[model samples]
Target: MYEKVINASYDPIFIADKDGYGIKMNEAYTRVTGITEDQLIGRHLKDVVKDGIISESVSLKVLKEKKQVTIIQHVNGKELLVTGNPIFDDKGNVSHIVTNLRNISALKSLEAELSRTKELANKYLQEIKIYQKKEDMISHEGVIANSRQMLNVINLVQKITPFNSTVLLLGESGVGKEVIANLIQKWSTRSNKPFIKVNCAAIPKELIESELFGYEKGAFTGADSRGRPGLFEQAHTGTIFLDEIGEMPLQLQGKLLRVLQEFEVTRIGGRRTIKIDVRVISATNKDLESLVKRGEFREDLYYRLNIIPIKIPPLRKRQEDIPLLANYFLDQANQKYHLNKQLTDDALLAMKAYAWPGNVREMQNLIERLVITTEADDITASHLPFSNQTAFVPQPIQKKMKEVLQDIEREMILKAISEYKTTRKAAEVLGISQSALVKKMQRLGI
Candidate 1:
């Protein structure tokens, strides 16, 4: 009956003799630890896992001191809560020591959720304190925008900053998603903790898992030099911004979902599970709902992340803000290049009239180009590149219109690559920004 109960219990149940040898362990324990019964049967508890404290010392302490020792551990990507105590024999001596392990993956996830909640609460309290004392909360420059669309986005951000809910920022290329995430962190209670960003699309398919969640040394070929920390682990007490999360390979999606659910990360090839207090704010340009229905993305993970969704309208959608955005960028250009600047009505109109595929970021570069390439503060239509006389003509009237679009896109990408030496650069060339580029890549499934 006792053996049956141990076997039936969902908690990893095991019996270790006074000598610290495992006398028995149920299937749950084996599954959670990934240490088979065959290997651990006659072995000492220390051999179970390197970081596990179930060594002879812990066993001895429990046997001699007659007290319970509870420890949290990581095993096979799961968090485990283990309680060890001495089991006395008929002679009233410690003959066997029993260890009750509860797979705390669920508990750890809850704790992580609670930690994020508490962090937001603390951030609000701190913000209130700062407001009460200083009378203002300064917005960081790289992170602020007065573009009417961006203004609305910022207002929403302020409203949501006090909560730990997962935020998914969506938009066309060039809008600064990372900047928004940084703003979120700046207002978060976990501001003092690390803020790690992982570009799911940036990492090679083979390395994405190890990069985001880390791996045990020798877990796979080309592992990190010292088993480096993963994005989730590095974020520890702070936030992890998962950029282009839609590009994350299907295989790793389940693992990421587990991390979100369990609030603990198990390193590859390593037995210890580490608890984390990370607020996950994921951004992607991909339509996850479509992916879910198509069976390409996990429904559970989507539901978890879709807790809060904020869409960043593409630059073209918010054309009213172009004038302000251009002027602000011109100011930045002047400060950086020491060039006095002004945009002529025709020049500004041309820019305003141009369908800004790249958004605010594209306009910024256009201003900078007008600043450096032109010789005057007053940049006219002639200074603008897209305002070329031929640009206004519809491509369908030309031969191979479809081909022309591809060629245009290809040329722009290549030019950006040549200029920026990266996809991030190419995205900039197309008038969208980096995170926006990430979205395009996800959309293109690139």
Candidate 2:
């Protein structure tokens, strides 16, 4: 019955005598080792090892050690997990050694595949996180500004909100001219009214008039049979933001000037004149003065648009704001990508020192790129693409040591006040009396 049970088992099993000689083996053992049972039974394990039928004998180790042993064994060109357990007699002597063998090639292959799958899953998860962060940052609302120049611009915007004066925003491309336009619309009394935006540069010269003024039916070939209201008429009783106004065609400029002066529009192939009450907010990156001088732009239109000119300073002129902007952008990126990343002191210094010709938009894009590509939680100078680029290095300004010390002291006092909130607490933090701290703050204009 024992022999029948052993023979019926799926795992390979072999039993050895006290002297390490094979006494009996199951049919599975013979099948696994590719050896006949007649040849295996009653044969010494050392003899099987010497004959190269099995690589090593765990049974022999168990017999010598008088304990259980497990090892990897190579037999008949297959890998196996072989375990040998000793059976003890009354005298604590190893009476027999029973060994079991299990094939391990399939398990090893499965382990490797699982490892590869985990690596791929981790890679894809990181990519998805970055994409999510980008969406979140891009969807953030409001203008990000803290510089004095920008503050003045904001003040000017606020001052003009009560009236319907035509505002002309002037700045280099990507300096957020559109953002100012939107702010104007939001602050105006007509905030609930529709604020239409039109890019003069993007529209064709032939379609400019029709796009700006409502066209009558059959006004021209391929005109919509039902007729169409132009952007100006559509923005009636609201605001119309015309971006890149310098790109307006010479002839269209005359018509636009007329509409601005008369507050009326004449549709193509139509006799009826339409009166409209729409606020015009024009923006341009080009110099309208240059265009006027070159006869490319109407001088009358330039004067009308320049009534309330607001020039947005480039990012380089507002270097003190870089730290604030950088941290803001970093926070946005972190919220977007579901990650916590910070800029190193050196990284911030490097950013502030560099000239941003592409302006605020460039800084925003760079911050996003660094957040995504950098592996470290803290973004160091090495992670910046422009860190090694040849850039403008400012000449050091000569200053007295006492003056520099005063600057450092003022900065420390401001920092302590911000952190502690109360003058007494700030004084304790700075190791000074509250009265003295107040005196210094007054002198430093803190």
Candidate 3:
């Protein structure tokens, strides 16, 4: 029954005589250590350790000390916590030593994972503090402007904020035109008043007229029961930001032109004209002059909105601000997603080299995605979705044909790996075996 209990125990059990010769071992001992009863039962503990079968013998230690002994042991590449207890005979002499072996590999693995998680949490906290300090210094009302062009734009905004002139913000779609509009409103006398923003492109042509100019209660089907005021009425004592003015339909352009000229708007089905005391701010990425020449836009209305045009340069043109903006966006993403991600120097270099067609908006989205998807804390050049190798790293003036070929090969492999996001898929795309691709990557230092 004692043998049955010992064999039934989940933990491995080993028993040896007081002389340190193994006397008995359970089935669990054989399963855990991969050592059969024949191999260890007749063998001495000292011999087992000498033969490199186990790291140490807790039973031997217990025998020497005449007391219980606990130790960490390694057997068959597994970590174990082993405890040995000595049994004394009636004569007060040690008679037997019994040991219990508990595998601690899973616990060790869990401990390592927890340690990594803690380290990442601490890193994220530190990153947040650093960025918060920098944000306080460099940001102006949530706008990051370090480049000369952007600084000049901000200066221009400050100059024009006191005036009620119609300001036209011209830039690429993601160039923060709306931010400039917000700045104007924030610094203007109408800061306390309502600021109505209408995206002309987002609204449908059929409803835009009613939406912008307001309509009577029964103006059309699906109309609001109570008479609703338009965006211009909503901004009677404030400012109105019209985004994507270029996409405003031509038919509605005449009414918009009249509103700009008279500061009065007649509702879609209302006879009375309401005068609005509001400042107008319009922004567009399209070339209004070209649109005017094409008759797609009204030339007269164009001049009205262009009274104080502020052209925001694209992101590629203002490369100096990339680092600041990148860090700012990274900080935001970390805060939002609870991630600890940082960009490497090479990653920053790659960003500066690439032509940001989508401008600041792309960088913001990409940073958020990296913060969420990246496994490592440091986001390196390899982690970037797009890499411009020739622009990022200056090539040597003179190179051998073999070196040139190697450069092309390296570029191709890097591009494939970055695009596919895995060695096996990249290898398949490159028409090479996974092992060959790995070997090539190693040689190229990829």
What's the TM-score of every candidate structure?
0.56, 0.56, 0.58
Q: Relative to the true structure, how large is the alpha-carbon lDDT of every model?
A: 0.74, 0.84, 0.88
Best of the candidates, lDDT:
3
Given candidate 3, what's the lDDT at residue 138?
61
Task: Output the better candidate (1/2) by lDDT.
Answer: 2
Off by more than 4 A, model 2: 1-141, 393-446
Q: Show where candidate 3 strays beyond 4 Å.
A: 1-137, 388-446
For model 2 the TM-score comes to 0.56
Candidate 3 global lDDT = 0.88
**lDDT score at residue 19, model 3, on the 0-100 scale:** 90
TM-score of 1: 0.56
Summed over model 3, clashes come to 0
Judge candidate 1 against the unseen true structure and give its global Cα lDDT, from 0 to 1: 0.74
Error of 2 at 325 (Å): 1.8
Best-to-worst ranking by lDDT: 3, 2, 1
**Candidate 2 RMSD computed on C-alpha atoms after optimal superposition onto the true structure:** 18.2
Candidate 1 per-residue C-alpha lDDT over 171-289 given as tens digits, one digit per residue, 9 for 90 to 100: 66677777788888898787888988888888899888788888877788777657877889999888999999888889988989888988999988888889988898988877788
